[model samples]
Target chain A: MFKDAWLVASKDLRIERRSRVLTNQLLPFTLVILIIFAFTFDTHPNLLVTLSPGLFWVASLFAMTIALQRSFSLEAENQARDGLLLYGLESAGIFLGKVVAIVIQSAIVELFIGFGIVILYAAPLHEVVFLALSAFTATIGISCVGVVFGAMVTGRSRDSLLPLLIFPVVAPVLLSATKAWEDYVRGKVSLGDPWLGLLVVFAIAFGAVGVLTFGSILEE
Target chain B: MKSDRAVQGLGLVAVLAIVATYILGLWITPPAAVMGNLVRLLYIHPPVAWVAYLAYGVTSVASILYLWKRTRDPRWDLIAASSAEIGVVFTALTLLTGSIWGRPTWGVWWTWDARLTTTALLFLLYVGYLALRRATPDVTQRSKRSAVAALIAFIDVPIVHQSVVWWKTLHQSATVFNASLSPKVHGEMAWTLLLGFIAFSLAYVWMLIRRYQIAVLISKRQEILLQGALDERMSTV
Candidate 1:
């Protein structure tokens, strides 16, 4: 399963590298969101600093949607889905592969947004270890659930439906991640543990769910 | 058809029970020490919220049945879909009635109170679940995807409640609805509340059975239509 997952992940990454969509399109899109947010907040460094944790997650969440859509759309073209299925790849592998690819893309965007927040919002960089851990666990949770819903909504004409379906369900992740980031950035290490624990639990629960259920979704 | 008759009978009983509860709650029950006549809304509000939770619970269980390999059945999918539709309606009612209850008591139509926030999120999640059902055109595919989605969405209910409770405690604001959780109501108020639960449960059964039958009929109609289309194409060839 791990080997199959790596193969699929590498294939997706190779396709992404060749197309440069993530770098050229999505990264700039995320930066544009950060800029828009800065402008919306009137670029008051103090206010921006206060709201930066939420803004960071909001940007990552939006970018996560686009990343999920791109990953699935890669298969939607040229009957590639049938190719994947006919090749006798395990659905778990396909699911993990897609999830890994999304995690990587989302993590990069998240890191770039982190830097953007530091520069644009003047957020302190003291809690580097906590921030990275929060982002890592949150990204895994988002990608696990996101890929399932992404595939669920594939071939549908209603473009906004995926976000609608995913956002409310993922509210806890947003809530916990934001709270943890806020506590960490405020230099209160103890206050961050519960939120961080919530993130880890979410990631593990959904990860198992995705693996068990992906084969059923693929068969359908 | 027999069950349809039974459902109609149950519907009549539900209406009567609801009417009784309303009358007793509004006129027979004395004003409370704190809330006064505004407590009347309590009967309908809690009952409606109960049905909403009950409906979603049914959906979740039915979804599990649909997904399990040994127990997969089309009826389970229909039950899940029907329960969800009813669940959404009741959830909307829960929000509206909750707001009405809040207005006089809390001096605001809405607040970020734990119960209210959690219930609102629950409504949106299931609304998404229903929308998902509409998006998938294939029956088998729709069943599989929605069942899984239903289970995922159900996981949020407890978490949302717990998180909101924690959030509320951290902020230390007085909760709007926690008073009702105490088993303190006595006399007519307590009886009426019990009647309210019974009435709503009956109503849920009636609506569920009716909706499930409608779903079965719709699927049958779709099958016949497909058969007719295939027959026409074959004749043309």
Candidate 2:
């Protein structure tokens, strides 16, 4: 079942590779958002330290929302959602595949944004390890909730409302992850301690809930 | 007739309880040493929040039941939808009163503290739930879709509650359950909160039942009208 799910997910990736929609179009928009932010804010070290985490995470989340919403569209538009259902693959497996694709897409966007921040705002390289860990956990937390929500609310108007609804419940993950990153960059080791625990708890809890609930949600 | 009587009785009980809570909270409850009359705001605020959480809980349970039974029962969806709106109201009230209370206590109308921020987010989530309902046209599909949202949304309830403890924020520590309050309960304030809690729960039950009835009647009428249209088309053909 898991292997079949991986095949279904790879099909999505292969399609994206052929089309290059995410690469040619979405990547540029992400770069544009990051560049716009960098020039708009002050370049002072203290101010950059304060703004960096929020800028990176918010930009990455927005970019990922656009990506995930589009990821399911080809299937949904062609009634492939029905076909996927007919394939008898576990809904959780389907969800995990989409989530994996989303995390990778988001990680790419984060790397671009991180590079932009370092270039424009002069972020130190030492904190890249902590930033990577924070980004990895936060991406999983965000994608876990987003995939289910995107599937559930697919055909509704005001589709933009998906992120608004999700960002709040999943906020602690973002808050802790970003805070930890900021603390690491600022060399505040003490404050970063509990934030690691917070991120882990969010990822585990929401991932479990999202996976358990995905099957019920996938039923028409 | 029995259900009607239940609704009427619950309505009266809700009214009486609200009046009792108001009287005790406004006049009988002593002013706080630090916040003076602002402390009274606590009575109205927390119960509204508690009831909001209660409403969301019911919505979640009802949603899962609707999906599990494959009933698409109008009553279940109606209950889920109604409580979501009511939950939004109570959550809004909580945010408003908390802000009003904050101005004097925290010296800011809004601060990005854990509780206040998370409560604000809960408010956003349900507002989106309400909006999603309005957008979808089909009854079964709407219920199904909203049920998914409701279940996903319930996950946030615990997170919202514990956000303050999880992060350093301007919101104060929970006083009632924590060590901050004395072992002896302050009788008048406690009584006021209890009354308010009871009244709010009664109000939710009364309001939900009323909303459910209306939704069932409307949908039934629509179904009948749709069937008639189909019949007319067939006869003409």
Candidate 3:
């Protein structure tokens, strides 16, 4: 099972290496989201304190949702999911592989957009290290759930509906993570701690459930 | 199963429950000192919210059961659909009474308080679930999709429940369930609330049995129609 899981994960990584479509999609999309935020919201330093975290997560989430929703597209579309099933690989292996790849994929975008938000919005990064830690924890939470939600809703004619279904339930993470980000930007170092705790909790809960449920959902 | 009998029984019970709730709520319960006649809205409002949440829970549990066995049991699907429909009705009642209660007490018809906002969003989410099921044509696909959707949507319930603690809002926390109720409220108002809860739970069960039967009838009709169509197509071919 461990070997199969690693192989599945590496398969996705190899596809990305060869095509680079997902990474390509994330870079431009996240950059544009930031640009739109900069142009749209008042970029005053105080406003930055107010909006920085929200802008970062919202952007990262949108870009990452697109990436996550597409996580299974390659396997699902060409009947490759059946191939994977036929390999006698553990279903949980498949879920773990996809989720790990999604986390890695979204992490890249999150790091870029997260730092860029600080630079563009002129947010004080006195706790830049803490902000990154908080954001990373929150990213894992969102990506963990997003992986399952994305696959669960896959194969629908209307693909965009995945986020509509996911965003509301996952909004707490985004909302809390952004709150922590705002506090970190504002130099209220202590305030970010609780939100950080919530983020980690959210990530672990979803990841654990997703792992357990993935096999059942994948069963034919 | 003699479903028609269940429906008839459900209708009878629903009428009786409504009458009982109204009588207990209006005449039996005492008026509030602070809110006056407007406090009567509590009898209807809380029951509706309670039933709505209960219905959503039913749907969530049913969805899990359906997915667990892949039984494609019509009864399970019926329970899910019926509970969701009944839930929507109660949610609407909750919103309407809440708004009415708000007008008299808060001097506004609506407030962006956490509870109110969360309750309103809950209505939208379930309504969307119903619509999603309606839009899909394939029964299997509908079953699978709505099952997942129900599970995902139920996650919002806890957040809605905790919105009071999570955010700063004007909405008061659980009045009946709160720790610090005055003796006056505890003696009289608590009894009224207990009666209200009982009445609503009965109404929910009655409605579920009725709606469950209706759903079964519809699915049965659908199966017959599909069979007839297939037979015609085969004969022509």
Best by lDDT: 1
Q: For each candidate, how many residue pairs have backbone atoms clashing (under 3 Å)? A: 0, 0, 0
By TM-score, rank the candidates, best first.
1, 2, 3
What shift in Å separates residue A50 of candidate 1 from its native position after superposition? Answer: 0.6
Candidate 1 per-residue lDDT over residues A131-213, each given as its tens digit:
99998999999899898888788675536788888898788789999999988988888623999999999999889988988
| Predicted candidate 3 versus true structure: per-residue lDDT over B81-134, tens digit per residue | 889989889989988988888887888999887788778778877876786677
User: Best candidate, TM-score-wise?
Assistant: 1
**Sort by DockQ, best first: what order?**
1, 2, 3
Per-residue lDDT over A177-205 for candidate 2, one digit per residue giving the tens place of the 0 to 100 score:
78887777777665247787788777887
Worst 10 residues of 1 chain B by lDDT: B169-178
Would you estimate the TM-scores of all the predictions?
0.93, 0.87, 0.83
Residue B87: error of model 3 in Å?
1.6
- The CAPRI-style docking tier of model 3 reads incorrect
| TM-score (0 to 1) for chain B of model 2 | 0.91
Give the number of the best model, judged by DockQ: 1
* After superposition, candidate 3 runs with Cα above 4 Å error: A13-20, A43-45, A188-192, B1-6, B9-31, B67-72, B107-114, B117-121, B124-152, B155-169, B178-203
* Preferred candidate (DockQ higher): 1 or 2: 1
Full-model lDDT for every candidate? 0.86, 0.79, 0.77
CAPRI grade of model 2 = medium
